[model samples]
Target: MIDLKACPLWLYRLLPFLRWWPNVTAHTFKADSVAALTGALIVLPQAVAFATIAGLPPEYGLYAAMVPAVVAALWGSSWHLVSGPTTAISIVVFAAISPLAEPGSPQFVTLVLTLTFLAGAIQLAMGLARLGGLVNFISHTVIIGFTAGAAILIAASQIKNFFGLDMPRGAHFHEVLIHFGSHLTDIQPWVATVGAATLAAGILARRYLPKLPYMIVAMVVGSVTAAVLNARLGQEATGILTVGALAASFPPLSMPDFSLTAIKQTIFPATIIAVLALTEAVAIARSVATRSDQRIDSNQEFVGQGLSNLAGSFFSGYASSGSFNRSGVNYASGAKTPLAAAMSALFLLLIVLLVAPLAAYLPVPSMAAILFIVAWSLIDFHHIGEIVKRHKRERVVLALTFVGTLVDLEKGIFLGILVSLLFYLYRTSQPSIRELVPDPAELRNPRRKFVAKTPDTATCPQMPILRVEGSIFFGAVEHVQRHFRNVDEADPDKKNLLITARAIGFIDLAGAEMLAKESNRRRKLGGNLYLVGVQPDFCEMLRRSGQVDTVGEDQIFRHKGEALQAIYPRLDNEICRRCTARIFDECHVALPDGTPRAVADQREAEAALARLHAQGATAS
Candidate 1:
């Protein structure tokens, strides 16, 4: 553990804001300036589009991208994770908040801002409490599946604007497609023409023109087409729809709702949003870190995202989070540090003041075209293929989550996580226990592999051995009991079983009980259970559970020689007297019962069996 107080300047060094201050040099400034300018240009259209998705005032999305981003960059850990209104979170917020009030009502905005504040508080508390490790419970496959489903939803939602088909508000993906298909005859030619023109220009610009922003290119193309259609054949005759007007002013200060009833209603949704946002932000940061080779502190990320939303709630912004496209673009555009994220917000503020009026001219079809691109990039086909091929169990989790997100966005991720853990537990319930017979070729050295396929020749006359591997836990109790029963019930001559426990990974309370009960059961059958090479922790657990007393310390041995020496005396004297095989080195010595190795006749009987085992490669 690091003692932060040991270093005088530890507090200052650990803070992300302080660390980035020194990197604000001329070169960094120039790189960040270009990146920031580019980010501002990209965010303008996306914010409005995302706002439309969230069912909020068009300006609210812009507000979310501005102040919250700067706060998150300054307070959070990652140098390149730019927080803003994201597609998945937008859809969730709309799905969550739209039903309670009018989509863009004053009351609805207050409730959303309030939800943001509460979510921020929850996240901040978890971070300060060092619950960052909780994110691991949500697997990466779940996120991938959820995002893919969300992308499809994004496309489905825009089908109305995409082809001038009237889709029901907040329609399910299936319903959207069904409605669009049913209303195919009602498609407006001029609207379809504008939407298609935007799609073509965006696709073409992205494919051929590497320098210009595709959003701008697509918007211009779509708007110009809409304009020509409108002027040539009047707005009524052609039905060339447009996004009427938007206030071009800066984000105004807004207050969050603090009523008990409002808090009660939004709290559950806020928590869900918090989990999704943190997972999205952290996952994006880690992905970017892999490309840039930078380390990310998840705890700090939680705090940063929390503070961002907290600031957002007071700044007229709704709940927002990391955008994969913006973050990836920031990294690809040569961002030197987190300052680039902060600078994007600063530059966006300036851009808003100058060209916010230009947004009224931006057609809705054009915005949908840009979001279609955003949705397309979220699918990770390569990783999806690898997961499907390499792991069969994960495929179910991936498929369920991917399908469920379209059904219900808020609960899909949770369902996936739940299923993944169930599969893990099922896989771990039965540990591996293999019947081990000694190799005849390794008689002299004894340090050789046990041949599970080979039949035992009962070289020792009485002892049986098996190797136990993996953890002994509550659910694995039955599997282990069956293994013990198999060994003991194999042959009446093979009455004693010695377990080679060096491979046993861990032991819990239930494991200790099974061993104790098995030991007593074998004792009733005139046989004994002995443990060899038991780990110290396993022993401690047994002792704490009072199972060591029941099994007895004398029955547990630290080494093979010691175990064999201890059990030699307990072997049936009649069998040993008639035995030919004295396979162990300890068998040459006096047994623990003080019985010496058989005289002339006894040696002949044991040696006869030993020779037979040597020829057959077997020992029981």
Candidate 2:
């Protein structure tokens, strides 16, 4: 306990686990165990499919679920996240390796292992460097759109097996459709029957039998149904297929090819897989964390996922990442710690060792049907509806991501993130700059507070109060300048401009330059520019950027009273003496030159009122 407590503050900062070490308990252990068992059951079929997608042997998928799941959970921030083989990573791996060598060949497997290793290395480096902010670049809109699209693609890919259609292996989306269309007449009715039956049973089990493992139940029903059909119609008459027998064993120790040829071929493909896998893992972790109200550390998650894959590469496993189904099941089952993911791997190893041979009776159509359910569950219908009804831009992003994923798996998510970023930058580049008028109705009683008010010609002429909204960055320079230009263009004779700088979110060099330029321009016209309630960062930027020199130091004021006092002298004496517009305390006194305006004289007051009327000015 003292050793744990003796950790330096900086070390604790770098490795946050030191803070949470004290929270482990018997209750947490009990919760984690149940979640782990549930996760193991969920991953059983998915591991096989994912390994097949990644161009690895059936057992490799199971191996991927073993060590990697535990490693990620042990080091990761999220208690519920279970990292392992995922469809997106699998498809990406297939795409990457297929271009280099034939699928299922030794060369293909070697290249995939190398790619996994490299990806793991990259993720680890990023985590150590605290580059977790990379996740922020992938906008929420992009993730939502991309996941929805990926879910559809998952369903689409299974159509061939579900209908038992003759589509060529590794067919692109367009090619799959064309192949299916050409072979439309060749659909096997018996295979469809088994698939549909399995789908229904799974759906019903999940909806009604909440305690039962739905996927396992559905597989059993489909298998039993297929077996009966095979017996009744004779093996040759009923062409229902099964997954064949699986090899029963623990996660085997494996080797990755370190050959130059393999590295050269695998590096590019590995990068794609790495990025996709990292994204899937982080997104899953974040989703579960959100429901639990947990503080998830992205960098720590990166470290965990990286270590898991690195271990997986040596354990007869292909590339792997987080599984939403397993993670969600884990959370719903009430997992309390990373131990749940660790226990899941342990349970899977035991299950595989005992039940591997039994998998031969499991039908392929049943697996496909189960995947359809998983894919469907991934689609958040309510969130999609919200996106469509509330946010038009996000809806477009969702559609694009979904379509793009259908067309090409690797590029869809990347495209969505790029599009979202562009929209964000566009908004930031043109900040809102508004000319403001004081709430004349609330002036006398500050406690009266503000109501909706607008400016007009009858507004105070001496001070043109304005509000600068949003950040002032390099890209926003032209917009801020144009706003200032338009301010005096409306009425240059007003002579004084008061800027309420509170709404100005942030400022950069370009913003400071524009401010300096505007100040000089206003001074040239004999009008003074005053700033009120400037933010610290904005003021610091002005000082450091040397823009404070261009705009005089005394010119920056903190409040309306100070600004009025400073600009009083700069106003035209002729207009002030003849004017009845007593908009400020300074206006009630003599002119800047100290010549009194005898407004006490009733006739002078009449002339001033008439002049004010002529000028279309109002008194509060």
Candidate 3:
């Protein structure tokens, strides 16, 4: 075993699998092999179905499951993430290139290869640039919504095959529904029968024989039923169709059409595929990692996915990403390392070579039924319900993303992200600015506590204290300014403003300048601004912005006591003399100018007050 920490950068870059290579033990090998076999069986029908969705040959789907799967497993970061042809990527490929070239034609295949190459290149570039953190911008709500929409699309895409209806190819969601409605009379009974049987068998197996692979049971049931129906009713009477025999060979070398027209047509779609694929792969990996208690390096996963696609383009594969079904099954089957994913690809190749011709007996409707199951599982209903019931903003994001995905699969997530970000910015831009007053009872307590101002609490008429509860960045400067302005309009006599700055999380240059300007305005009004419990960073920002000098260095204090001690002597002496609201200890002793009326004078004054009260009592 090589010491990875001491290994050179170039060596690790060349062979990322080395990081996990040492984890392959005798026990793990046996565990991974079992997982691989299970995953291989699960992916077989899915590969063909996904290929059919992409308008590619059945063999191409099997090819995608082979080399790309192995490459991704070896190079990717996740222990159980199995990369291959997926429903969303396949649909996107069909939608993008179908208009430019006929589906399943040489021209279409070449264009797809080119598109895959370009997308892989883009993904690789992004990963190498360490931009994997970009996926963080895609919110959990957006993912849930997109997944739900994609699930619907998946079921919708299989409707024609499941029912044996002759709908036009590459139709939109609404179009598919409309066409299906109009062609209700054209539904073939045998096909629907097979699909229904497969769907039922899958559900039963999953419920009762949880240890067995439900998809295989469903496929076998659907196939046997189709054969029995054909035998009984005659082939002409039963319109059951089969996914034709797949070619049993290693992925053959392929070439892309690098023509300018082809590049022009596929480049933009390629960009979309790259982003979508990376997002899907990383999301699946992270989801499974949570269950496995594993840490996934997203950047490395990106690199792995990119390289797999790149290798795939030259080896007869189309756009592929992390397959949730396979990954989940892999983990559930006790996969211990990435080797399981790699072995799954190897097992799939062997399975294809051995049973390529046997696929002719597999009914297309059964495949669709399996896909139906896959689609249903993709939706996270528990989380969706939680979002809808608990979070209004998240619910909006979820709805938009879900609807957008149904309408436009690739762009829907972007719309959700946009809305989520806008909501975030709006919230952050409006921080809480509240008026606070020292609790009179807690004033004598060692740790001074402040509470929201109420009419019952005695407060100094000259100085009003306010608490800032969020960052004072440029976006929030206007809001803070408006608050200050409101305070001024509400009480002109409260010119000496003391801000409790402990809650101000951050203060940018604009906030510093604003504070300075407010301080100057208050000074002109015969008072000034003071800040208590000012954060060090905020003070540094004020200093750097050259506003500290404008707002007097003495005005900033570490504690409220120091600020009050400094500002108490600066208040108007006339106001103090007439004011009865002696809220502070300093207020009772002397006026602002240190004019200490003697203790003897206070006693004499109290005696005169007592004499007046006695005279009033006698008169009464």
Candidate 4:
């Protein structure tokens, strides 16, 4: 075994696969081989289906799943994440490039290759710049909603092929539904029968054979059913169509359109694709990592996905992203390392080369039926139900994202992210500010704990203890200022303010400046602001901002007890003599001016009160 710890940094940086290449052994190789074969079989149908969705020839999907998968497996951080053609990327490709040129034409394919290259370049740059944390801003609710919408779109797009309807190409989601409804009488019964058979076979295979690849099984059944029907009913009677045989050669070297016009048209779409691809890749990587008990590096994943797409564009493939189905299956099939993903691509290439001619037997309706199953599986019903049944705000995000996705695919995710952010900012802008007072009940207890101020609790009229429960930033400065103003407005005598800073999670320059201004204002009122249990970082911020001088360094204490001890002497003796709420230990001992109080009289008063309490209890 190679000692990775002793390996030089440059080697690891140049060839990241070196990190895990040392772990490959005979035992792991056998495990990975089993997983690779299973993944290869699974991707065969999905690749073709995704290609159909993207308006590309079916062979291009196989090409994408080969080179790109290998590149990403070797370069990425996750052990089980498999990169290939996915439904979202397929729809995005079709949506982005369909307007530029005729679908499946030479010009359309060139534009797609260019777009793939550009998106890969952008992803690579972002990874190099360490911007992988940007995906965190996109909430899980947004993903759930967007996925549900995309699933519906996927099903809608296949309706024409599934039922042999005369729906126009590249129709909108609602338009597809409308066309399907209008053409209900025109549906070919033979095509529908094939699709129904395929769907039923897929559902049954998945239910009975949990470890088998249901998609390939479904396709076989669908093809056999379609072939039998076409043979029995005759070609003229049955209007069933078959997907033509795919090319058998390896992926050829390709070039993207570099014309200025093509570049201009595709630039914006490329950016959208880059963001969407990275999000999908990282999310899938992390999801697989959770089950495998591995830590994923998001930045590394970004770089890996970028490199994979770049490789794909040069090798006769369209844009690709991480595939959740393959990755999940890779993990569930007992893959022990990233080698399984890399090897799956090789196996897929060999399998496709051998079976390319056999694709002629695969019915278009059968592929459509299999895709319907894939689409339904993508919709996470359990999570969606939980979001709707439990959280109100998250449900709003989920609904908006789902509806927006049905309207527009890319913008739906953006809208969901925007709503989630707005909700986050609104909540952060209003921090919880509470007034606390020392509990008279725990007066003699060793541990001092403060409780929320209530009518029954007697608090010092001159000094109010306040606790802030969130960060104080520019967005929250106004709220914090208003809170401070309300305190003085309600009780002018409460000039001395004791702020418990332990609860303040963060404080910015605006917060420190506000503290300085408040300190100056209190000084003018013949009082000062005291901070108790202040965090060291906040103290440093205050000192660096020059607010420590305004709110005297002596006023800042490490413990609430210390601050209370120092501020006790500053209260007025006349008020202490007349006060009945002996909230502090010092209040019971002497007057504020160090004058000895009648300790014997205080003890006698306490004894009398105890006797009254006992008599009241006896009466009850």
Candidate 5:
């Protein structure tokens, strides 16, 4: 036996399955077998439906669920995430390829294979480069909007099959609606009846028979209804079409086109799919990992998904990603390791071999109805409502993405991402700057608290304390400079500026330069700028940028009290004598010139008493 303990780190990465191989006991094997069987049952109808969405032959969907599932599971980080043909990826594949070639044609299949190969290659490169974090830039709102819009397209594409209309294949979403509306009178009763029955059966099964695979139940119901109608009123009269028997053999080996023209045509689409598929796979893996209390390696998952797609391109599979439904089911069924996902592929192969012939009875309208259900499930109405009702920025992203997707599927997501990033930059460019004053209630307490300045609250005429909350980067340098300039511009007497820098998270070179310049400007105006509670990163940035000496070492302090004590003596003695706002402990006792303020306080009290006496005489 190989000594697993002596294995190098590279071996574990090269064969990720080795990490968990030693933990697989007989009990775990039994558990995995049961989960695998359940997953196989669940993916059967889904694979067929997803293939239909992708505009490929029914058998291709089952083929996708086979090899890709095994490869992803064995090579990936997650134990339960099942990689297969998902609705979003299937719709994307169809949208990207249909414009280039006829749907369901050999040419279309060939282009799809090329796209898959390119996408897989890109994913592998990104994984090796450790760029898995790039997916984080594609916000969750973009995914939601894109998925919802794709779901609409999926339903629209099936209108022809569901109602037996002669609409052109691969029509845009709006064109489909217009055609359906104009051809309302041409709807076939038998086809519509079959579709309606399947839809109702699926809905009921999902609601009442939660434990059963609803798609299978709905397919059985629709097939029986179609058979009854066809038998009663001849096949010619009813005009119902069936999906025909799927090939029962294993997935045949295939090759992707490698011509320069094919690669050029598919490269852009492949990039889109590569990023989208990686996002979907990593998100699903991490989600399942959360439930299992497992730590997920996103880069490893990326590599696994890439390898699976590469394997798929050769084994007659199109682009694929992690299926949340199948992964959730695998976890819920008590899957203990990635073996469950791999075994599920084997189980699916066997199940497909047995049930392949039964597909001859499955009506096209029934398949369309099942797809409609799948489309509806893809929309997260609860989250959509929350976004629309609560988050303004996210709502804008959602609306743009949803509309853009309906117009053009491939570019819509990118537009959404761009808009969201712009919004994020706009926000981060203006950090929160608030003028602060010592809270009267907390002044007596040793830990003097500061609250945002109010119009009624008094502030020192010479020195003003402001808090900066957020990073000070290149984008924010102008905003910070504007705030600094506004301080003395609004009030000439407020020459000394004290910044509470504890809230500042980071400072880049631009920020350091801006601070140094502001300090110089303040000194030239017969005042100074001081920083209190500056973090280590802020200091390091200043030091590295060679602005520390420019800002002056004595001007930066580690604590609020120390900074206050050092800065209080530097204010103009004339301004301190006239100032009524005793905002600090030192301000209450003496002037900046080391002179006693007791005589001034006594004279002010006597003056107030004399004014009251004169007011009483005038009243008499």
Candidate 6:
């Protein structure tokens, strides 16, 4: 046998499952099988509900849970993330493709397959390009808002079946509300009763039973309730509908339409799905990894998700992603490795084959109720409340994303990301520039600690020290320059500026040029700009940009005390003669010109008395 440890890095990357294959002993296998069974049972009702949300036949959802789930588990980096149909992806798929073709039609399925294939291609390309960190751009607030919006959409889409009203398919959120409002008189009592019964059963099961799968319980309850109602009042009296029997078979091979028109139609939506899927998958993977104490390779997860979708499209599965619920369940059920996720697909197939015929007894209204419960679970109310209460910018992003999603599902996330990025740029463009003074309490300390300058604090009139607490980049050049100009413009005597550069995170080319120019400008004003605690990266940037000479290499210091000692001897002696601030230790002994400060102290006392007399004269 080939020694796996001797394998090349590329081989491991190409087949990630090989890395974990060695861990599958009898104990792990047993644990994984148990977790797999639990995950499969939990996914049964969810997969069908998600497929219904995607406007695909119920079997397509089960198909998605099979092949894609196995493929993702094998290829992905996460040991616990279970890939399958999810609420957000399902809603997005329906919103995107329903407008292009009739929901649940042959043409619609074809378009969706094409969309899946294209999305997989994009994700694969991104993985190969190592752009896994691209998902970092999508802020958590955006996800919360978008998920909340999609949840509401899911409930709105189910209104027709829940209340037994005739509404147009794929109606926008507002339109759904309006249609529901106008058709209140047309509600069928028996159908509404079944939906309500199922909803109540789901809520009660979820709250009380806690251990059982609530969706399955609710479905059984609704199906039995509908059957009893139909038998009692005859089928003609009650307008309740059944989901009909699902096809019981392994996922069959399929082909996506590769026509130019199909490709053109799906390309843009495919890109959107690719990004959304990657973000969802990676976020879920990392979240699960945190608890599992596993290191997740985001690029590998991207490749896994891509390959799953690619494989899924050929196996009659639509777009799929990491399911938060299923992944959480898998982990909580004590899954040991990726094998658990793969085995779940097999367990699901066996479960589906047994239960496929029973689906004919499942009521449509019950499916709607199950979806309502799923949707309700999707809204993160605690996080939403925290965002609203804690941060104004996050609240704005949440509101805009939620509202925009209600308006247009596909573009809403993009809009939220754009707004959040703009806010981020605005913040980074104005770095904190605070004047600092030596701490009076730490005056004798050799380290020379500093504090922010307060109104009562006295400063050296000729030189002011400031601390910059953010990156100095092209976007912030104008703001930094303005601060530099304001220093001397407000008081021409304050011509010299010393910056504590330890807090500066970065300095780009534009920032380096700006610093060089500011240094020159200060020198022309009979003063100079100095920096202390300059970081190595900033120093390297200065050297690379050829601005070190202009900035005066000697002006850069390693310590605050050293900088102050060096700068003290460069101050104006004439100004120092009458100044009483005496903030520095050197001021106690001698002036910048090395003259004894005793004479300067006598002059300062006389100057103070003269200033008091002048103030009295002005008052008189």
* Candidate 1 deviant stretches above 4 angstroms: 1-38, 244-246, 385-391, 435-469, 491-506, 526-536, 551-620
Prediction 4 global C-alpha lDDT: 0.88
Across residues 231-295, which tens digit of lDDT does each residue of candidate 6 receive? 99987899999999999999999899999999998898898889999999999999989998999
Comparing candidate 3 with candidate 4, which one achieves the higher TM-score?
Answer: 4
| TM-score-superior candidate, 1 or 6 | 6
Candidates 2 and 5 compared: the better one by lDDT is 5
Candidate 3 TM-score, true structure as reference: 0.87
Given candidate 4, what's the lDDT at residue 494?
78
- CA RMSD per model (angstroms): 5.6, 4.4, 3.8, 4.8, 2.7, 2.7
Q: Per-residue lDDT for 1-620 in model 3, tens only?
A: 65766778788777888877877899999999999998998888788878877888888998898889999998889999999999878877887887778889999899999999999989999999999998887788987898788889888989998999987767889999999999999999989999999999999998999888787899889989999999999767988988878898889999887889888999888988888899999999999999999998989998999999999999999999999888999999999999999999889999989989988889989988988997898799999999999999999999999999888876787789899999887887899988887777776654567889887877778887889989999899899888887876788888888899999999989989999999999889888889999988999999899999999899889987777778889888767776777777676567778867455347557987999999999999
TM-score of each: 0.84, 0.89, 0.87, 0.92, 0.96, 0.96
On the 0 to 100 scale, the lDDT of residue 174 in model 2 is 77
Give each model's whole-structure lDDT.
0.82, 0.78, 0.88, 0.88, 0.93, 0.93
Q: Could you give candidate 5's per-residue lDDT for residues 589-613 as a string of tens digits?
A: 7788777689667766798899999
Error of 6 at 360 (Å): 0.6
**Model 6 worst lDDT run, 10 consecutive residues:** 439-448
TM-score of 5: 0.96
Off by over 4 Å in 6: 596-620
Clash pairs of candidate 2?
A: none
Error of 1 at 300 (Å): 2.6
Residue 62 in model 5: shift from native, Å?
1.1
Q: Which stretches of candidate 2 lie over 4 Å from their true place?
A: 9-19, 52-55, 99-102, 291-293, 445-457, 573-620
| Candidate 2 Cα lDDT to native | 0.78
The alpha-carbon deviation from the true structure for residue 412 of candidate 3, after best TM-score superposition, in angstroms, is 2.2
Pairs in steric clash, model 6: none
